[model samples]
Target: MGFTGMEAQKDEDLVTDLTGIHHVGSYARIDNLINFENNSASQLLLVGQRRITIDDVHDSDNGPLRVSISAIETPLFDKKNQMIKAYSNEIVAALREIVKMNPLFKEHMQYYSQRIDIHNPYILADFAASVTTGDGEELQSVLEELDCESRLKKALELLTKEMELSRVQQSIKEQVEEKQRILEFIAVSKLLGKVQGRIICLVGPPGVGKTSIGKSIARSLNREFYRFSVGGLSDVAEIKGHRRTYIGAMPGKVIQCLKTTQSSNPLILIDEIDKLGRGYQGDPASALLELLDPSQNTSFVDHYLDVPVDLSRVLFVCTANVTDTIPGPLLDRMELIRLSGYDGPEKVAIANQYLVPKALEKSGLKEGSEHVPPTLSLTEGSIEDLVKRYCREAGVRNLEQHIEKIFRKVALEVVENLANTSHEDQHNFTISPDKLHKYVGQPRFTSYVYLERMYDKLQPGVVMGLAWTAMGGSSLYIETTTVQTKGGKGSLVTTGQMGSVMEESTKIAHTFARHKLEQVLEPDNAFFEADLHLHVPEGATPKDGPSAGCTMVTALLSLALDK
Candidate 1:
């Protein structure tokens, strides 16, 4: 032991925190650990001369250890001791499995692999734990365990779980790749014949990849892609083309789409067809009926094309946020498919398979040759954290934004480090939960309904409800609070930007609560004199659905019960 003295008062606090079971080790303590002179703390510069153990810890009159130092037993290792030898071999084998699962550990593991004393069970256990640093609690458990067998057993269990998890991740990656191949094949072999001269309308919530699917279809067919939005378009002349008699005549959008693509069989995507409206020029929706009709379009004549033009080879696809607004006759001409947003597991898989690699390339994180690990990476826990916390969306638009945000920060750090150093070290940032906030800012928000369910602590007059929208399903909370009026007369008040449907639902809920209170509560309870104000949060967002009816009734009953 060197530099034997620890700060007199703070020594016991540090003693309690010591987790290791080592019989011989040393650490120094300083009373007021910081210093004002030269703005540096005092250093405990100990020179190790020899190893020793404290045989006795006598408290004397000083209230601290005034001990005698002695030499203790050294662990003996014999290769012939099969029990000790077996545990030692198992630890090494488990460490190798862990290394195989995690590529990031491979580079640093070579040194530890060669340095570990395989013959000594205790030494092997310690070496394996250091290489596979599982977690604080697990590491501390291994540190305090004096038995070599127990230490090796614990380390093996931790490594086994890690290896199994890695296998699942690898399997998911392969499945995603195979799915991509199958989709491409289906596009070429079947979709070409299915929608040869027909139109397709993708109906889904915004950001649900409707537009991207259109582009993907075009790529799969090896055709040029062109898109134009007909939102609020209301002129028939735009579809049939302007007559040559007009001073400035032009071809219709269909002819222009064919001309710009230069390929007669190119894909044409019409965006927001449901948004078309009436205008003085003419009804564009009516003209679209003529263009999309299979019998008329084969030799379709445009006013400006001035001749029969064949449009049967030009494939048309359309997209809309909702299908209801599309004219019934127009919608009948196309095949429609709905794309709901992804679930949690699906989002995580997509992030790993498509989003992560794309973000790495887009942010230039793998730009230089020496960026050795290739791309900035996310730890498994971090990927789960990002999905659960930062990105709770119907679409991955916000998820991609957050991922891009993380990479942009990593890019800055890499550039700054390179400028400051000799460029000898590679900058590969592997993000985990602890370091997540350093890259992306705080998560935008925690969903109110999610928090309510997680805590499972609901106050009276609060009820959960399910809702359906063009986007998808969502859960909302309906809260009813009672207010006593001055005149002993009560009128119900409703908030939450509710449409007429919700307003009527609220009134129905109020009437039911009144009848229920009459049956349950005492006849003269003060609750009858109080006005009830019902509200749903996020009032700026309009909500109107019959799905919330049952919930409103539940909330009103809770308020009446005052439970």
Candidate 2:
């Protein structure tokens, strides 16, 4: 071996400079021993002033040889080894598949593949060292493998496990980042008052929990809730407040609401906002626009106090039966959330879960009481029957009222029968579908009753129609027939307290029917010559809108063609 910068250095100091390269020939007494099983290398070499170029070495000492410095270099496998040539392509292809599964590992995979030594039967173990950098006992077993193909298999298995762990870690990092981004977005939105500051308007039929939802929001936020109705509010001063100079001057409902709640940021529910009245005093609906607008409400000025009240933090929820009567400008500032009425199944569920229990409590009918006998049993079928037969309104207000009425009667009957009847005889008072009529009187409504009553009337000149009213949806019939009047030429007469829109609809229907039936009718037919009367049933009730125009046309056509 030839060494540079070796100026009579101590043997211990030479150990520090043992990392440099050197040339060692066959003649040199160099012994570098590496135990593949131990997973460690031992190198012993003798450095001299001159390089040794002899082809053979002659050593006489057989005793243990000691060296102060050491280094080891493992040799590559023979290129002519047939196994390496046969298996190289298969291992490369498998590595390519792994790289495709993890694109980020491509550079590392290439570097490790280039470092593989064909002489090392544990070429896979050497590659895995670069890949995993782990000295695990499992990897030690792979290092001890001596077979070319078997070691390659073990190395690939180790690489697969490391890749799976890497993928899982990467996935966890991405998920945490996504959650952080969402949290930041929500924080930013709330900080800027972009979503939370808008005034929300709940539009639905009566008793649909609009006001209740407002209270729920307040309770959830740990804020106070205040509700007031403006159904017939007319004076602008009621909202903006009367001036301090006026008699009995006071702050507007907004200030009153804040004072009642005793919090600046309390939730204020404005009920019946759609029914806000407009009179000579001024429009209350118009006054509400300034109070509801998030941008303007920050510095709301009340006339009575004549001071700007910071109402930006206050949450406003307005409730209305419908949005038609609400002022357009005021409505523009609100975010509308429409709640539809509960159907039969929903009402039955609510009655069973909440309404029935509330009624029992209110009517002094204690479930499981000696006089009441067992828990107040209201089956789902019976509730469904009640919902179908007694209450058909859009809202549950009527249903709740009917349940309360039934409970009141049951309470009364139980008290009277407490003295006269035995415990077994009390079963007569147990509420069921058949006995429902006895408590609430006859069902206020019956399913398809109107349609059944009008079945015979639905003839050649009559057509069934649907109409919506303040109460609920109902069936209507349009009847068309010839009306004889002396010297009266063909004319149209509409009854049923028809409004201007309905009158216009009747005229349009008559004109359209005449045009459509022109070819079908006889040339000498008196269908158009005689006066036609279009009469809607329930003549005393006022009706409007063009919804019934199709029914009117159908009835007119039926009468004209006698079909």
Candidate 3:
């Protein structure tokens, strides 16, 4: 035990010696002899001159160890001197904010700070270093620096860093308070798991009013509405947030939503969760795992905010074209609600109730003080014609746009003849079924849905085929016939905007037909001697896929057997 204690004491003594000595050959004055003439416990002013270096250390017989030193001179060029002056001025400016934070330093610094020489930039730097609250080692290192410019630069760096760290600390404090307030609100309401079932996911095709429905829901609940689009969002930072190390980094969508809505509990519509793209930065889907997952999200932490944000109070409603496109784990956490595209009745109702009135008000097409004077009404027959000729889509977006167009045209006429007693023309500006063609040009399309079909009667080489798609089911015709014959080297031809998979299926079907034909054909029959062409009609639709495999095979067999 005694030996260990002796060794520890020796190590401590060696460290003290090493800490005082640096490459600059300087000494740290433990007690100032020159400044002893005036001893005021309130403050001690140590004026800096030049950097002094120790030459030798000697032990006195009765008193204490003494050091002999020499002054080291360093001459600065005009550029470096100016740089030092600039940096020192910045340090002085930064100290104002720093001193306000530290009272002990402020009280003593207030007196000498005002009288300090700003002209001697090196002296100003020393003034700040001496009065500032910092690590003793760092202060001594600055005191040891001989180069005036380097010393000032290092002091400025330290001051700037200290101020920045203080700001971040303050920011974190405010965020913590904000988080606490939100948590308290959540605690009182305690709506964590209770509202997850109310999490409505509106999944349907684009322009189907999924986003509009989310806004309506918010309005009904008397809550603030905010929409966050995660479509094509590849960066995980977009969901989580970039770290503070990144310049101009900020909180992710969830935290940003809270800031934007200005309420702890706002209805947030997360749009296009399915269309999130993956990239090298990170998988946004994985980041959203913690965001949407209710159990894990009670304490959601964004990298930029670096705090556990309580997203539980903020209701999240997601919208997507298809649920299958959403990540499995993410989809599993929410209540999936499938919203089909509007039918003809639903589309017409939406246009009549919501769209026409809104567009008329916006276009200033009114007779009285109120902008919506019910002056313009789209006749039901005209609406039906518009639906059939202009738009027959599953969504009402196109229908709404067309309605907007009619109101816009009428608005222009109202403005043009405002001075000309326009009551006659404005009141009779109703859009009738016949007048729709006058305003929007001739009927863009007939009330006929195009379908792929073969000739009325079954031909020897043609077969009626059926296919399914995202748009719906459709029937098509596959036609095959003999095209060329030479040297018995039969070649097959395929056409009709077929993709790679479709082309390969046609080849497979053709091979299967030949195999079957060879078994039934007499050895002398020239059934496989001619080149044949296989074609699918309605080339405009760009048909492709293995869905047509069976139809292609049946057509080949019909051609081979001449049935």
For TM-score, the strongest prediction is 2
- Minimum summed lDDT over a 10-residue window in model 3 is located at 1-10
Query: Candidate 2, which segments miss by more than 4 Å at Cα?
Result: 1-191, 194-198, 245-248, 366-371, 419-427, 446-453, 484-488
> How does model 3 fare in lDDT?
0.70
Check candidate 2 and list the clashing pairs: 76-119, 77-119
- Model 3 lDDT tens row, 1-563: 00011223443533223233442433233334333334543333334445666567676665533656677676554655567667866887888887665445577677776766656766667776766545555776776676778878778766766665454333323435332432343334444434453345667666776786666546534469998888999999988988999898988887888888899878889888889999999999998878777677889988987878888767778888776678888887766655556666677777888887777777776446433335467899888778777876667878888888888887776555564664645556667998987677777675434432346588888988886544334577889888765456567888888889899998888888788888988755665778888888878778777877788878878877888
Every candidate's lDDT:
0.71, 0.69, 0.70
- TM per candidate comes to 0.59, 0.62, 0.55
Candidate 1 per-residue lDDT, tens place, 354-413, comes to 787888888876545354245457877777778777877687888888888888888778
Best by lDDT: 1
Residue 557 alpha-carbon offset, candidate 1, angstroms: 1.9
Give, for candidate 1, the lowest lDDT window spanning 10 residues.
Answer: 13-22
How are the candidates ranked when ordered by lDDT, highest leading? 1, 3, 2
Error of 2 at 305 (Å): 2.9
Given candidate 2, what's the lDDT at residue 413? 68
Q: Which has the higher TM-score value, candidate number 1 or candidate number 3?
A: 1
In angstroms, give how far residue 350 of model 1 lies from its true place.
1.1
